[model samples]
Target: MLRRYQTAICDALASVDGGSFCEDMWTRGRSGGGGCSRVLQDSTVLEKGGVNVSAVHGTLPPDAVTKMTCHGHHDLPAADGEGLQFYAAGLSMVIHPRNPMAPTVHLNYRFFQIFRRAPSERSGTNECGGEEATEGESLLWWFGGGADLSPSYVFEEDCVFFHEKLREQCDRCDPLYYARFKRWCDAYFRNHHRNEGRGIGGIFFDDLNENMTVSPEKFFAFAEDGLQTFIDA
Candidate 1:
């Protein structure tokens, strides 16, 4: 799904800019998995941009688990004894248009899963190099993502249009999503020193899981629609 989004975004950008993206493939050693990075720079319509996708799995250190717990992922598998196994995949992109009037846009959508390591796997004896869980059972999983615009100069109409488009997408999934995520975007992007947001807010959400009122599948659909909305906007 992430790769699909990557392709769609790159194609859309290329079509608009009449430029092609250079692709770089990379692999994660010993841990597992790999990804492709597609970038376009100095294009006719875009100054620079990249659409990347990656899937990786490995063991999480205890400290990392602690931080996640503190950040509201209290259900993550305990990493105290043996580090918890983890899998993560995502699509991220940022676009900087050649025209300064165009906003610099950023979007990211990701899925994360945590699993308990089997005793035999904990000793670093797994055939898959300790990256794969023997039971293949996920203890917890979640979806997170957001899209926002940052313009060099604020245009009230542009900001309003961007936000309205995002709200429309969010409303398709859940009426409450727009209100909740808009507040989150505003709060998350606030600059403490300046006492204001870095830019006009769009929408942001994180840690969406089965525990929420919506199902994971619904969130996935929301992400898909959100990506399309970004392309249109």
Candidate 2:
């Protein structure tokens, strides 16, 4: 899904301005997986824009695992010197248009999974994520992210159209998702110094899991629909 979106979004964004996005393929820390970043700078329609996708896996620092406070933490390394094995992949994009009339938009969709390394691996007795993971070990996993819009100047029509389209999609998954995630977006993207909302909220969520009464397949479908609708908007 992320791979598909990466190409589609970059192509659509650059096609309008006749500018090209530079593809930067890179590897993560050490042996971690790699990803691609597509960026466009100084275009006719956009000031700066980027669409990045990555899948990284490594032994997470033990301290970092504790902060997450997620389920099945005891199974993962915490105070021990060795860290837990983890993997994450996602597509994230941001667009800043040349004209203030064009709203700034951002979208991100991601999945994260963490699992325990063998005891020997934790003690440095065995290398972390050393082919042991592929044998079939998965502790916990979930999907998260959202999209938002910001406009220097308010346009009631655009806001209405954007939110309405989002609401329609959210309703397809759950009747309450729109209002619920809308409030989340508003709170998440506030101008703390100014004491105001950043812009009309769209949808924002983190740590959305099956416990939220939706399946993994449903959330991925929802994210795909959101991205598709965004290009149309």
Candidate 3:
């Protein structure tokens, strides 16, 4: 999915200009993992931008694990303990268009896996009745992400159009999603020091998973919907 989005976003942005996105593949520190970063700059449309995908694995620092709220994983080991294994992959992109009238936008969707050292099957299923199975010492995991529109030149109609499109997508995933996430976005993008918002409102959510009454697959589709929205908007 991340790979697909990497290409789709770059292709969409590239259409705005004849130039193609430069691809940079990078390896993580400690040889944990690697990902590709596709970027475009100084184009007729985009001033600068990047669509990046990364999947990395490492032991989180003690303090960092304590700060992770996804699936309430605080009790899990952070470092040299029973298991400190962690894996995270995400598709994140930020677009800065040359035209200030065209808003800068951001969309990010990520998945996390926190578990003990375990080698599980691809299905993650148990032999007993073929029930759902988790690898050794599985601790917690979930989905988190959102999209926002940041405009240097605010357009009321554009804001309404963007919000309405996102709302339509969210409603498909869950009828109650829009209002809840809309409020969440408003608070998240606020600039309390300046008493204003950094961008027009969009949806923001975190800690989404089956336990949270949302499936990972559904949310992933929602992420794709958002990517397309930016491509078209």
Candidate with the greatest TM-score versus the true structure: 1
Weakest 10 consecutive residues, lDDT, candidate 2?
Answer: 122-131
- Estimate candidate 1's RMSD in Å: 4.2
lDDT of the structure predicted as candidate 3? 0.74
Evaluate model 1: give its TM-score: 0.87
Go through the candidates in order and give each one's C-alpha lDDT.
0.81, 0.76, 0.74
As for model 3, its CA RMSD to the true structure in angstroms is 5.9
Model 3: runs farther than 4 Å from truth? 69-83, 118-135, 210-215
| Tens digit per residue, CA lDDT, model 2, 63-132 | 7878766644344445357767777778899999999998899888887887676323222111222122
Q: Counting only residues 3 or more apart in sequence or on different chains, how many pairs clash (N, Cα, C under 3 Å) in candidate 1?
A: 0
Q: Who is ahead in lDDT, 1 or 3?
A: 1
Candidate 2 overall lDDT versus native: 0.76
Writing each residue's lDDT as its tens digit, candidate 1 over 14-73 gives 999999999987767754656789999998999999998887777788888889889988
Tens digits of per-residue lDDT for model 3, 25-93: 776653456778888998888989989888766665656666664446545665554335676788898
Q: List the residue pairs that clash in candidate 1.
A: none
Best by lDDT: 1
lDDT of 2 at 175: 88
Alpha-carbon error at 205 in model 2, in Å? Answer: 0.3
What's each prediction's TM-score? 0.87, 0.85, 0.83
